[model samples]
Target chain A: MHLLPKKKKKPSREPYREISPGSKPVKWIYLSIMLWFMGRAIQAAARVDKTVKAEFDALPEGFAFSLGVFPDGPYMVLGKNIHGQVKSLGRRGQEQALDVRITIKNIEAAILLFTFQESTAISTSRDRLIVDGDLSQACAVIRILDIVEVYLLPKIIARLAVKRYPTWPMTQKMIGRIRIYFRAVLGY
Target chain B: MDTKEINIIQHRQPGIVESLPYNYEFYNPVKICSGKKAMAHIPFELAAINAVRPLVLASDSPIGRRAIKLLTNAFKESEMSFYVCDDVPDNADAETVRRLTTLYLEKNHDAIIVAGDGAAVDIAKVIRLMVAEKTDDLEQFEGEIKLSHAPAPLITLQTFDGSGLEASGWATVCNQTFFSAQLAPQICIIDPRMIIPMDIKTTWARAMVSLTQAVEVYMAADRNPVAINYASTAIQSIRKNLAPVFSNWVSNKKRLALINAYTAAACAFSNNQPGPGFLLGKAMAQMGNLNLGTAMGIILPYVMTQYMRKTNCDLADLLRPLSSDDDYAGTTSSLRGKKAIRCLYDLQWTWHQAGRRKIPLTLKDAAVGRYLFPDIIETALKNGLPVFDETDCETVLEHAWEAKPLNVTS
Candidate 1:
């Protein structure tokens, strides 16, 4: 039975799957949502948390700093207003000449921080944040962020998110929590 | 110390304050002669330092021989007279220092050229001190004695890149280490030709020594911004250049980078007190008959992990220089410090894989037994930084003895 050996079939080439470039619009939408949330969080913190306001007030006028993931990630600048409020300058580039810029190493780190899955101390320890410019100013910024977290988050979450949680009076804590939640919802 | 205690300690933010209440003084006065054929400029450096006659101190090893040959060749055409003493032993005891000092005075050598590894450089340092202080009694110079007058003009030509003795204010004699600003060399020449001929293991070990010192400086309680800058830059250079130098020994550029790293690290270390890791590693090396670098290489990561476990301080800042932007970005902050330690482990593994004589990753890998833990712990407790008590020393030593791959789960 000297049948001719079946000729080996050449494998069919699969088409190269190209990623849709439509991801740009999706990313922009996600970034916009993040920025909106961040802005509202800052405004609420400033309205409710005296410590956060104090830290912001201590900053020099026109002092701005950006927080975001590198490259294509969303960025938001929090600058000291002339009136001593910390306001988000919206999504901007390096044109602001920020005094102290803090960049989370990646989007994952940003998510971890924003979701209160990790504290600033833990993130800094983990090497997830890159601070450029004056370290003292960066420290002040970190203090502000920590205070804001206390106002926005529950005591349990805030305790974990900050290096040390200040012992606030019961009435003040209750009032701060209420104001922060209301302002956050109203986008004040 | 427990994690809570460490956190509390770290909570006192020194970096944030306008001026830290703590005061520290830093001084380094070493003229560096680096780049291609840096040794060729030695005569000129000697002249600049106002020295007509120079004495070369080296070991009897191949490096010492080559150093002698090179220096002899460099001065062949010039009228500059130099004497060679290649008999300096590996263990630079008081006897060797005294003898070298006698030789220095007898020959009327106006300057010294320490041209070997740590031991040779250290011996030369002691010799110069002896000549300057006019005392062979090492007791007078023990601990941190301030020398009234500067030592004779010393030009250190380091054959190996690790010891930082080339620019360090400290020198080890026998079992004791002495420190003085006068011990720092006046001129340090790092030529690639001197380093290229050495075996890869020796080269790597020396580089590891420099790295260990730099990391310790970074972790020290006395850490200042200037020291941090130097240590960070040194670490970055080592991380970038070490593997390349290991693979391609012929590359002068890579060698120069490593040399620069050594110098920077030495400068930083000189300004700060030795940390627990350095103290423990030195003791362990003495106990185990291991190279200081070998002990340090095995112990550093474990020490760092211990530091992280105790303190709330962010060790992740170290990763900024050692890692690429992409890797740094991708890593979460909470994991960054751990990632830095892991990176060091991975680097050690890479070096072991590449080298003919593999570097040990664990104490067991180096034939260092757990039985020696009690001795190591005791020695470490005695020599370790005051911040770490006996318990911390034991914990760190035990972890180092195990030498297993670090996991986040503890």
Candidate 2:
């Protein structure tokens, strides 16, 4: 019904915008230092804390796990030695064929876990983490983390971070806490 | 009525009453993550299921775009990557699904992240199915429990409006119905940032369906204690949040509570069959004129009363969620059913007033004449739920025609 020839105009096209993923440098730095302390603390706890030693004993020898943020990480790698000792392998665990890789999805989620804002159980349930290997080993590692947390933080903060606080005698708690702290900080 | 007719109704009544609720099943695979940072957890959820690159299907509307933006922001620090195809068409036709499926295969997307209502989600689910089965025969995929193996991990982000099946293990792609618990999203993220203000009609209609579906599942004969817990939570949340949610001022917390109710209701419904109310609503929507939620809303009270009078359905438990605990406990068991049904009437009226009387109170008010009643019933029968017969359907229709949910019986 148009009297004149219809004219068609090409539609305008907008340029695509790329969404680049961001990094939290401050959180990564903070988490790196904390992971270092915790990695050493786990090695120290297995020597001093009988419960941690028993947990490590239950795991197969050479059981190694990487726990921290993915890609670039403030990560801790722990492995059981052939001599029945647990050792902190620093971040070099990624290079080894680890039994488990427990990764916090991001640095903020790691902050939530390390700052005692969220418990290990709560963080796992909330899906702030990813466990990529043998689930049984991942669960055991989580237990080790919980035990080490009790030694590192005060009872009030430790109680918030662990599912159930252990009923240790006042002396055992006091003595173990001191020994674990002394060995963890001094690397003795 | 003839003796034969009376016997059939009488026979069905006891069958429902004697159903062994003690021996039933309840299952839902979707893990709901709600709060401000819920979107940020999607990467972890996808990673937990071994999905690295997900195909993002979202609506192209402004609200959908805003939601996609908010969702993209959550992935900033997670080291995960996904491609966004926000140009999801409205119809979600087979052509679109096929195109997207080819695109998905071409791009090698590992999973699906659907960030809108039914259309986008439907396309994503169908695409997931085609890719999982590695076939183009969608027709053969129809029916219940068809998927033999779980597909790639799919996560859905609810933008406060959906087809009610978005979170359920059901998908209607190009009129072919597919059902499987595996088809349901592994994670349902309901962030407050995605709660957009929608039309009042759509708002209350969705609310009404949530309320009715909760009651329907709670009253189902094969209902389990776990499903009842979910249904009860939905009902209680709907009852408490309906008023404030409809007020002029917008409250994300209040609406988020309703969204949680919808999730609970969908979970409960997925565990059970489609109730008579839902079936008829679906039929009305299929007629091409009515909104499914609005249709369910209009007929819900009448259907509840019908079930109360005909079947030995125990509705006294519904009193707890319909009203206060004091009101529920104070009422005698015999009167609690009627009180609960009466409470639905009051609740519907609240929506009616809030919508400025534009919300239909009866079939006639909806401009759906009695002539269309038989067609709706016939279409409902095709749903094949075994929950309603012709007579029961007619009875509900007649009562709804007159807006008399409680007029017949005391």
Candidate 3:
């Protein structure tokens, strides 16, 4: 049987990428991106043991996310911060309060998800995400970064990003790449 | 320069059991060892192939493991190319065999050095059959047949007990279903070192099967001098060697005795036909889950006694090898036949004394009160056994049911 080499750990650094907040309408896009990656990372490290409270405290202000562990486990709760404001069209609009509550369980296995969304504003919206490998390792990393790039982000966002960019094939290639990563991480 | 065209194919040596193809050609070297680490004499066919192509050594047992390493080292020193089929499971399925065949085709291995017991040897045989016949159902090809076409040269290393395959162009296996021989191995290797690891129970069982084959042949209506000689040698070996070995495992003399019994048995069946003992052993082994050797051991003396009663006394000359001992030298022919019954009883006693559970002595004991005479006889008739017609069979079954000892009749 063939085996792959392990990756070398790099020095600690700040978040590599982040979706910046824009107008009131753009706020939904930024929150959705954060929710998507965070969800993938949580599912990826589904086997890891971490304090849910600490995870909730580490998230960026104004954004709330919930972590659910299928059956039974303590979840980190994040409350909405009324201090942040979103501008609608060109002018500042009233701040909308958001409450996020998540329930976490200890179901440590791989779960694959694929979804496609279409809107008049976006050209395409097909997205594929595969989360597998060691749950503990992923959980620890999620705690540290407070944000995950979601390598699958391109396919998910491509369908919603550029109007002309092809998403179907890219989604497939991305899913394959994710599968390879899971195999490498899990050493299957 | 005229170069010979060579085609190589991979074949699996399953540890459990397998069947062969009908169209395949088979060749057995006539010498095979039975036991844990059985070794066969490389056939002239294999040697002929060896001069031109490479021979791979294959096995998965601890004994086979050691042999593979030793064989590989020897081959490397002698400058031979080889491959070992050690990845597959002991009882391989059809898919696994196909995979092995493909690998062989890809690598172009000329032939194989098969080590292990009946399973390993038969697995290789089936592979050859598959290649030749283009089919894998061995049942379709069951029965006596001639194989004039030689398959890929395969050298079998035997380490268990069974004479049928060694003697005839056939192999039998149970892969959830029963299957029989269509082709034999091209070559066979027999080495006693392999038989040493066999437990007493299995050794006795295999010995019985071999012994029964020999005796049955001697009693067959078509009995020939050649078969009688083989059967006599097989019987004597069992009486002398198997008994002593069964008593003491560490004795070299006992080991030799055991191997001799195996050799005699294999030689007895090298021909396609089998006698009463062989049929009875096969039937019990199949129907009662009894070890073939034990079934034969238990039934042999009885079958012989039945034959002796209806025939002349001089027929006892067939056991001359065993009769030479001082303990048996002066015994009359009729008395000698009685000893056959005594010997089986002693075997049962020895098993109990040795802490091995005593097998049920008769059909009633074997079936736990279930009547099997009708069923056994029915199958026997279908299979063309001439030893007992319906009336004679009923009498034999009645005698067996009571575990009665057969003695000389005036």
Q: Per-residue lDDT tens digits of candidate 2, residues B85-156?
A: 777886877877888888889877788888788777777778878888887767777678566556877888
Candidate 1, residue B103: CA error in Å? 2.5
State which candidate has the highest DockQ.
2
- The model with the greatest lDDT is 2
List candidate 3 segments past 4 Å from native: A1-188, B1-45, B51-59, B73-76, B87-106, B134-140, B160-167, B174-182, B247-249, B309-314, B325-369, B407-410
Q: Model 1 over residues B1-410: C-alpha lDDT tens digits?
A: 99777566554422323233377777878877665455756655576567877878777666666787777655532346677776778886677678778878977889888777778887888887887788889876677867777789888776554365568888887878788876888888777777743456666767777888888776777677777778888898888877766664356777778888888888888887788778888778878888777788788888887777766555766666667656766788778878888888777777777775466767887777777777877887776464577777777777777775444445
- Fnat of candidate 1 is 0.00
Q: List the residue pairs that clash in candidate 1.
A: A105-B329, A126-B333, A126-B336, A128-B333
Candidates 1 and 2: which is better by DockQ?
Answer: 2
Question: Residue-wise lDDT of candidate 2 within A89-150, one digit each (tens)?
Answer: 86854577888999887666788888888999998887788888989878989999998998
For model 1, the stretches where C-alpha displacement exceeds 4 angstroms are: A1-188, B1-23, B161-164, B248-250, B329-335, B405-410
Interface RMSD per candidate: 31.9, 10.5, 29.8
**All models, RMSD in angstroms:** 22.1, 8.2, 27.7
Q: Regarding TM-score, does 1 or 2 come out ahead?
A: 2
